[model samples]
Each structure stands twice: as structure tokens, then as C-alpha cells.
Target: MVTIHELFQNDGQKSRIGTTYNKILYVPESVLQTIREYLDAQSESEYQGEDNTIIYTAKFPDGREMDIKCCGCQEESSWTEAVLFDEKGYQLTYTDVGEKFEGLWELEYDGIHYCVDVKPERNNSKMED
Candidate 1:
């Protein structure tokens, strides 16, 4: 079994799936704070299984809600996670789905909130030195 610390380390790795963003976005800190607060208030639970991943829930200040889960690794550690968007007509089937939209993707986990700009994950277009 892996601990949370291991997960954070694995998340920091810069392999193929976890490379630098191909794009960036700008949003308000207030909005990001709101999502963080909402996540901080939620109860904790684990989705355990060979294929099942750990999931949690949060409520936005606007009364909106969403779900998040640690993307479990079957063999090697996969830093990607499973996230669900709560807005109407927005159905997310995967974590990378967030890239399609260009706006604020407010999320919270373990009592902390974060705002993700849904732009392309920026990457170096030119060779690095």
C-alpha cells in the first residue's frame, strides 16, 4: 500500500503523462479560494478495488458540487487522477478532459482548494538547453 507522501512524489515526476503544461491560464484568486474552502469541508472516503480509485466530494460557494478521486495505479504509479465537473452539460469521462475547455476549473482536496485553468498543458516547443 502507498502512502500520501509517495503519491505527492509520484505526482511531481515529469514523465510523458505528467510533463509541463502546453498552455497556461489566468483566473481570480477569490474563485480559487472558494473552491479550496469547499473541498476543505467535505467528508473523506476511499474507493477501493483493483480498478476502483479513491474519491472525495466538495461543494462550491455558488451551491455547485463536484467529485474527485486519486487516480489509482494498477502496476506503475500513475499521477493522473479522476475528476468530475459539476456544471450542467459538462460531463467529464477522464482527467485530461479538462484541457478541452478554457476557463476556471475549481477543485478541492483534503481541505485545500485549487483552481485549474483548463488550457493546454504547456510544453517546450523548442529544444531545451
Candidate 2:
């Protein structure tokens, strides 16, 4: 499952003026594995990273594209967190549907918490609850 690493902090205020803020999530390796397997089953191609991370992307038969990033924390005993995006580069959210490996996530920026939900398995634009 995914958990908040840090909710709010003024760590790097000067550099990230108008761009994205700093937010981190701690996702378990098991969850990462499940996500990777799911992407692989969808025929997504994997991209290697210099660090212990892999990026997967694919354009579905329905013409929508998905991008997923799995990042491993060296200090956290190899646990990984995932960041998902669509073809337009918008961050996907995670929602807790009472499942073992599903949850919701919010990123705080400019004192506002924006919801980020996972893209549904189907090629629909509706957000998950």
C-alpha cells in the first residue's frame, strides 16, 4: 500500500517557484510488483533508469497512453513508490477502495492539497473513489 512520506514542508521553496512542489510517498515493494505486473500484462515497454527505478509506458489499443514510474528507496530497504501519468502528463491519483494494494493520494502545493487518483483499468476519464 501507499503512505504519505511528508505532507507539507517548505523544504525547497526558492527553486520550485511556479512548477511542481515537493511531495513524496512511501509505497511498498509488493504494491510496486503488482503495478509492474499489471503494466507488463498490458504490453507496456520498460525504460531503465540510472537509479533503481523503471519507467513503463504504452499506448493502448483504444489510443490512450499510460506512463508509470517505480522508484526504489535505498534508505528504506528497497521499498518502491509509483508515479503514474497519462499521455498529456497529468499525475494520476491513487484511491483506497478497501483493497490491499489500492489507496488515494493528495499532493500539497501552495497550501492546497490536490487529489491524484489512479487511472481506471478501462480507457475512461472518470476518477476512482
Candidate 3:
């Protein structure tokens, strides 16, 4: 499992926070690979060479999964975890990814942005909060 967090420097104070994956964000396999490479390269450039900065995890199509490590981009607040839903199929989520948001949405990672269209699950529960 990959664990992703966002680190921010606000008013000279360092803060690290978790990202919320409440929407459907999908990208091509190549794009995802590029992201991993970029992070790996950065890690190699660091002076200390400490490899405990960020973590990465993969999500399966099935619903059985657990939280995992994440990358620095996700840890640095550049990217947030999101679920992917098939417009005409079904919605699968794990502990790492957030809720499912359908329709059109945009995502920007490391100065790159992607547009996706998702079909969210239908809500028919009788209880409301």
C-alpha cells in the first residue's frame, strides 16, 4: 500500500496533511508511469538521498484493498487521491481512493492537467444525513 500526504509550508511553519479523494480522476497508464518516474528522478537528485519521503500504491478494479504508500507529488499537495468510475460500468473503490464523482472533471498534476468523464453510482438509500 502507498501512503500519500501533502506537505505545505505556511507562514514559515511546516505542515503535512492527508489528501482527500472525493472525486473520480482517471489517467492513461502512460501518464501514471510518467508521474512515478518524475518522482523517482527527484528522489535521486536530493542531497541526503533519504528514500523515506513519499510512498506509492496501486488500486485494483475489485473492491478489496487497503491503504498504501504514496508519492511526493501527492505528499506535496500537487496531487490528491481520487477514484475512477466507469460511466457505463460499475464503481470500485479502495481505502486509498476517495468517493466516486461522476461526469466531467479536470485534474492537474505536476503542472500537467487531465480531463476525465465518469459515471458515478446511483444513490438510492432511504437514509439521509
| Candidate maximizing TM-score | 1
Candidate 2, residue 20: the lDDT equals: 28
* lDDT ranking of the models: 2, 1, 3
lDDT of 3 at 112: 26
What lDDT score goes with residue 73 in model 2?
Answer: 38
Report RMSD (Å) for each prediction in the order shown: 18.3, 13.7, 18.8
Residue ranges of candidate 3 with Cα displaced over 4 Å? 1-21, 42-129
**Tens-digit lDDT track of model 2 for 1-129:** 123334444775343223222222234455555655533332223422236555344332222333335443323322223333444766554322221223334433333333333433434332222
Q: Between the candidate structures 2 and 3, which one is better when assessed by TM-score? A: 2
Residue 88 of model 1 has an lDDT of 62
| TM-score, one value per model | 0.29, 0.28, 0.20
TM-score between candidate 2 and the true structure = 0.28
| Residue pairs clashing, model 1 | 21-121, 21-122, 22-121, 22-122, 22-123, 23-121, 23-122, 36-113, 40-111
Residues 44-91, candidate 1: write the lDDT tens digits: 232122474433343344333444343433343323333544456254
Ordered list by TM-score, greatest first: 1, 2, 3
lDDT of candidates 1 onward, in order: 0.35, 0.36, 0.34
Model 1, residue 98: what's the lDDT? 23
Window of ten residues with lowest summed lDDT in model 1:
15-24
Q: Candidate 1 local accuracy as lDDT?
A: 0.35
